[model samples]
Target: MAEEEQCNQFKKYQDYFEKQSDLMKKYDETLFDRWLHGEKGVIDQPPQHQGERRCIDFNCCHSEMDSTYSMYCQTSRVPYCHQHYSYTRYLQPPILCTSNPGINITTKFVHTSINKNKTPVYCMRWTPDGRRIVTGNEKGEFTFWNGLQFNFACLSGAHDTAVRCMTWSHSGGHMVSGEQGSNGSSSIIYWNPSLAPVVTLKTAHSELIREVSFSPNDLRFASCSDDKTIGIWDFNKQVCEIRFDESENAVYSVDWHPTESLLLSSSKGKVRIWDPRLKEKVGMFSPHKTEINKVRWNKNGKWFLTCSKDFKIILHDIRMFNKPLMIFEKHMKDVTIVNWHPIQEDFFVSGGANGVIYFWDTEHSKPIGEIPVAHDGAIWDLQWHPVGHLLASCAHDQTTKFWSRDRCGDSLEIKKYQGTNRDYDPIIPMYDDDLEQPYLAPVFIPNQINPSRINGFHDI
Candidate 1:
């Protein structure tokens, strides 16, 4: 009687796996991990035989012992495991802007500060459609603002703690946010386009989450934390696929490549590049003298920017990162925020601890224009309008400010001279003494490759 009951249990398990195999083939293998994790409310319970080693293959019904490679799948009807299964390959074609607004840089723009919340603003992002702007505050409220008029649209209680980081999916179908850790607990929430909470992933970290970024494909997203780890999460599954626990200190920021699987992360004075598929870091370099507050990728994916508490912003070309292509040292205080133009890839802006916002053109080492006092306190976040003309900034002063160029503003008047000098007269040649100096033949020095700067470049 015992043997008969055991045989019946095996038959039940076989039938369950056969049904799963059919479902997996129709949906693809990515769902397999989700099913295992019991996410999306699709499966109410975990598999029964926890101690048994089932085939790892998506379509497999046979046990690990049945396959020579330790995995058996119904599709192949053969022995296979992770070693034989291929990783998913993702391709991202160039998503380039067709129009160009040539060399338009000026800080003489109209501006206003809005105080929708009494608490300080910690993070902000423009909606994917460019119709609304969302500002997350210290009180965990998300205030929506009209993208054009900068007026309040709506507000929602998004979290129980301060919303320290937030990101919208590329397709605008979903949004994710994280809160600063308090009382030894932190949470991450997923929302729909209407700001309605879909899932509240509680106790995501014991320490604060510093940043959250979505991948180019929008299938996966990454989160970095004060816990000194970077987590790769599946968007549909809402499960952490991998945790990179290699950082020596707190991870301050993370950004995915605009068109590739590459990920950039910053810690204390150090930056690392990671390839998520291989589950390993591919590169490392120390570009800042102190803690790096942020690292961002240009839309073109050829250049990236890093801002540091060292009071400097350094731009690096992806092809050659051994040395920075340009370093802007105009900030009088710690550089806290950096933002790239939405349309003009060469133009970017940086905000400092001194409340100053400086507009920069990558072609020049100095800022193209300056808003000497853009805010009253440390600027925590900066963003550009979808059209790339208007700028918005939030600071610890408990206010958010919008800046736009005066259509008739004199571009020449805002053109700053290079180096430690302040504003220069456009009509007067500031380097007059250099005009009389003897001309020397330009030297063509070759760039040297520093092999030690990166750990695993071949994988990139």
Candidate 2:
């Protein structure tokens, strides 16, 4: 609905509309939501030809800035047409860190793990003692590597299809493997790590097993699959002790709580914490609006993070359980995995579709650092080096690259800050129609749009 005062100010447009009153009457004059919020208010000054060319993000259609348009919406960082951009140039702008110019840290990693085996590495794991590294690739082969030289100890093809996942039993004597592709294909191999299979479990699901996590004890393990099931396997008996096939969609990932009592498994849109002993779901919730590609718990198990297809990473506090502790949105496409720094509980890294890895802090919702192109294609997995600040990112690009930091910046001493939010209910938008071009006052307009009406808020 049009605000009354603003409707009266249309006296000037009324004359022009009179020429085409019949056709104009067909559509209501209510502005789009952006204009109603007093956003993109007219830019009063043309952006000076600054040569620090800003790269266009995927959200922008054009490869570069158009000379006719000034700065677009600063918050959304997406380009808009003349009509849309002209109205949203104002409202509230973000208050950047100024107490100190806050040191800008660069993310650099020592490239140590790229083993180009002509196939993308699908999964990776470290031995319990962190002495050996095992990786499964797209071609259904496993490459066991020595921890020091990163030399291959053995390369074996035990599965007929892509080895989708791998995990070691608590004793580190046996490893569980999962595979994908080809219906009714054999899956789930329990290997003794000498290039031999201990007990090969047949496919319970029609498709691939996305993940397998050995429970804290060697007696059991949990596996989630595309068949929409989470199975708790009794390793000794070589049978699934219990199976949860209730997910409405494909189950994508699985993990065991450190306590060993709760098994965490996730499907598209929801995460369920199950008590395998009771054969019941203890807690289940949709952590993100989009598909939850991976769920990882912090070492202490107090918090866990979910990476999503919606480019959202949410940290969940098990105590609160109702709402996310914080939210991070940065990736351009689906976020495949998230791994907390084993030592640094508050920081984590997420990588997805484009092999881009983002480093985030749980206390804040934005990425503090990023590796724009860590791989050539979709990054399928991320594992932090068991010992240091280094991280391993593997992708569909057929290689695993290790990133190690040479230097981490010292913490900044932040001072007092001001917030635009008031401790009241139903807060008002920073600027309303009345303040920008108050509805109470008549508005002036030219017959056509031009940079002549450009006002404040130009990009730096």
Which residue runs does candidate 2 get wrong by more than 4 Å?
Answer: 1-107, 112-117, 193-195, 407-460
Question: How many Å off is the CA of 420 in candidate 1?
Answer: 16
RMSD for each of the candidates: 25.8, 20.8
In TM-score terms, candidate 2 sits at 0.63
Model 2 agreement with the true structure over 330-439: per-residue lDDT tens digits:
78999998877655556677887977777776656666556776788998888765543345667888886655331111111110110011111211123343233221
Which tens-of-lDDT digit does each residue in 201-242 have in candidate 1?
877877899999999989999999999999999988879999
Model 2 weakest 10-residue run by lDDT? 414-423
Number of the top candidate by TM-score?
Answer: 1
What TM-score does each of the candidates earn? 0.67, 0.63
Clash list (residue pairs), candidate 1: 60-73
Error of 1 at 195 (Å): 1.2
**Cα lDDT of model 2 overall?**
0.62
